[model samples]
Target: DASWISNGNVNGLGWSLKDQMGSEYFGLRACNRSLSALHAEMEGLLWATSCMRDMRITSVRFETDCSDLVDMTTNPMEWPTFATEIEMYQRLQEDFEDVSLSHILRSRNGRADALAKKARNRGYIFSHIDQTRSYGGVLRRIGSYIST
Candidate 1:
C-alpha cells in the first residue's frame, strides 16, 4: 500500500497498493470503530510500513493528502494520542536506507480518493481487483487527477 484516503465517520480507510512500476494493483479499505481520522491515517501508514517490510522494499516514497500527518511524521512535533504512531513511523523510517514522505493536493490523490469512495458506496472494507488485464482505463482516469 502506498497511499490512503478515509471515508466518512461511518465508513473506513482506503489504501492504494502499487507495484514497483508504480502501477496500482489493489485497493484495500477497512473499518474499525472507536478510531478517529488520525488513527486511521496512522493505521494506514503502519500497514504500508509492514507491507513494505514484507515485500522487502527498502527505498520508497510515501505520499499523503493530509498535510498535518506529513508534518507530524516528518517533523519532531507530536501529540499525546499519536505518540505510538509517531514512534512507529519513525522506527520504520530508520529501517530504510531511503524513505521519504511528502504531501500532495487532494486533487492529485484521485486514485486513493476514488478507491475510498468505492469502498464507502459499496459498504465494503476490502476489495482487490487485479489490474494486469485492465489497468489502462483506471490509469487514464487517475492521470487526469494527478498534477504534474
Candidate 2:
C-alpha cells in the first residue's frame, strides 16, 4: 500500500526534479537509482486494483504507473482520453471508479516486493510513477445505500 525509493537522474545525468515528477510516465524518480521497468509498474497497477477488489472495497488507493492514465482519466470529455475505442473507453471509465489513485515510491509497494515477477529485460526505466487521483466520489453515495 506504500512504496518509496530513491530514483536516479534523467539520461543518467543527475537526480530527478520533483516538480517534474507528474510530467513523466512513471512516478517521481529518486537520486542515485536504478532502472524501473514499465511492465512491472503496470503490473503493480493491476495488482493494486486486484488487491482492492479482493478486500471487498469499492474505494481503494493506487499508485500511478504513468501520467498517461491520470491525464486520460481526468479528462472525461476529451477525445484523446477515450482510447479511440468507445466500448473499451466506456469499460475503462467504469473500472476506474472508486480508484483513489496517487503516485508513490516503488519501495512502498508491499505486494510489489515480489519483483513484479517479470523478466528484467522487458521493463521501462521510467523515473516517475507520476501519481494522481482517480475513480473519485464513491463514498459520498454510501449513505444512499445505507437507507434511513
Candidate 3:
C-alpha cells in the first residue's frame, strides 16, 4: 500500500507491504521540492516497486487514494507531466507476477497517510525502515496505529 501527503511545497510519500500477520515492511521519503500530486503519486509508486523487489514479493496488491494513478498505470502513455515516472512504473510492473493496483478512499488508508504526514513534518527519509513513534501522540489522535 502507498500513501502520499502534500502541503504546498512539500510532498511526503509512504508505502508498506505487510505479511499475513501484519508485520509491515515500509518506506518513507519527504520531497522538499514541490511536485504535482500526480508526480508525487508516481514517486510513491516507484518506491513501492523498489520495496516489493527488495522483499522478493511476487504477487501483491497496491492500494492508493489516487484513482487517476490507478487509471494511468492501467493504461500508460506519454502523459505530458508524468511521462517518465509512469514509464518507469510500467517497466517495474513487468517484474512482478501479480501486480494489482486499486483505488481506495483516503479515510480507508489512515496508517499510510499518517506516516506520510509524519514524514513531511519531520523531514524523514527512510528506506525499508521499521515504524517509529516520531509523532506518536498526534498520529494516535488522528487514528494512526503506528506504535511507540
User: TM-score: which candidate is best?
Assistant: 3
lDDT of model 2 at residue 21?
25
What is the model-wide C-alpha lDDT for candidate 2?
0.34
Q: What is the lDDT for 70 in model 1?
A: 83
Local distance difference test values of all predictions, in order: 0.60, 0.34, 0.67
Please tell me which predicted candidate would have the highest lDDT against the true structure: 3
Tell me how many clashing residue pairs each candidate has. Answer: 1, 18, 0
Q: Which runs in model 2 stand beyond 4 Å of their true positions?
A: 1-47, 76-98, 106-114, 117-148
Cα lDDT of model 3 by residue, 32-90, tens digit: 54456677777777877876876678899999988888888777663556777777887
Local error of candidate 1 at 14, Å? Answer: 2.9
Candidate order by TM-score, decreasing, is: 3, 1, 2
The TM-score obtained by model 1 is 0.68
- Where does candidate 3 have its weakest 10-residue lDDT segment? 139-148
Ranking by lDDT: 3, 1, 2
Clashing pairs in 1: 29-125
What's the TM-score of every candidate structure?
Answer: 0.68, 0.33, 0.75
| Superposition error at 109 for model 1 (Å) | 0.4
